[model samples]
Target: MKQGVLLIAVLTLNGCSSISPQECEVGDWFAIGKTDGQQGIASSKFRSYQKECAEHGLGSDFKAYEQGHAEGVLLYCTYDAGRELGQSGGAYNKVCTGALEPTFRLGYDRGRKWYQAESALLNLQKTLEQNAGTIEKLEQRIDDNTRELSVLKDKQQKQNLLDENRNLLQDLRQLNQMQGQLQRDLKQAELQFSLIQQGG
Candidate 1:
């Protein structure tokens, strides 16, 4: 029963970890650490690997892993890497230090502004599209109601239709106002995005 429980625990840990059971068996700690560092993964990630490997009765080489990670992190902590990451809306882990941190952060900040401007423009465009679609639907509904009212014989039903048309017309006016506001917002957003694209 104890062995079965241990096996289950190992399996569960392996499932949660990116490191496979086969990787634990092979025990290439340095390479794993290097890959993680190059990807800007946190130092705490090593502890997770330790735990997963320990569950499988394997030993990890911390010294070798740390050495490899130090070298790999140099490659990750670059201006180009930071710019690409920020442009893609990736989160920074604050892994870079000292002089490296400043350079990377400068690129990251610039790219982040561009990304935000682009995102704002896209959101405004989407809202404008939705507003236009709603306005079109409201107009269609009002027209249909008007047509039905023209040929109606029941007085009570005709009154209900008239009331509904009034509400629909009010809604349509509000939606048109919203559409105009969205268009103005979209134009501003587009101008901001264009400025960012031009490196302003």
Candidate 2:
């Protein structure tokens, strides 16, 4: 029977230790590198493995790791991948170089613009709903006050209530106007979003 060695080192980087002892013992450097590359991690990530492996008196296969990483990054440097990253608001790791960077950046920009348009549309809708609630509350108040005014026999009190109701009406009109403008804005955002989707 073969015995497994415990290779864990309680070494910390930025307040956390990333690799377990079993990872060091298995020494699957190619797979590790491929994963990091696909995830768009920077080359400097290898230092973390180097530091951990050194603690266990082992060394990494740098040539094999780099070879696998180079292959894996090819998939990460695609248009759809870039767009997905942008839509998720994830940062680019700046791993793609030379021939790939320009195309990926273009896709990222398009996706980010789409996300912004969607966000703007939602905000406009929320504002419109809030305005509607405010208008409802104001209308309810006006109705209550008008009912009270109708039964009042005192001339001065009835006149005051009438003036208050008039003010409420004016406020309701302004809110309606603002709501109209927000609706227009929402339409424009939706149109822009649709255009983006069509273009993509």
User: On residues 19-125, what C-alpha lDDT tens digit does candidate 2 reach at each position?
Assistant: 65566667666666666677677666778878887887877777766876787688788888788777777776588888988888887888788787778888888
Worst 10 contiguous positions by lDDT, candidate 1: 3-12
Give me the runs in candidate 1 sitting further than 4 Å from their true place.
1-16
Candidate of highest TM-score: 1
Give all candidates' CA lDDT scores.
Answer: 0.78, 0.77
Q: What is the lDDT of candidate 2?
A: 0.77
TM-score per candidate, chains pooled:
0.84, 0.78
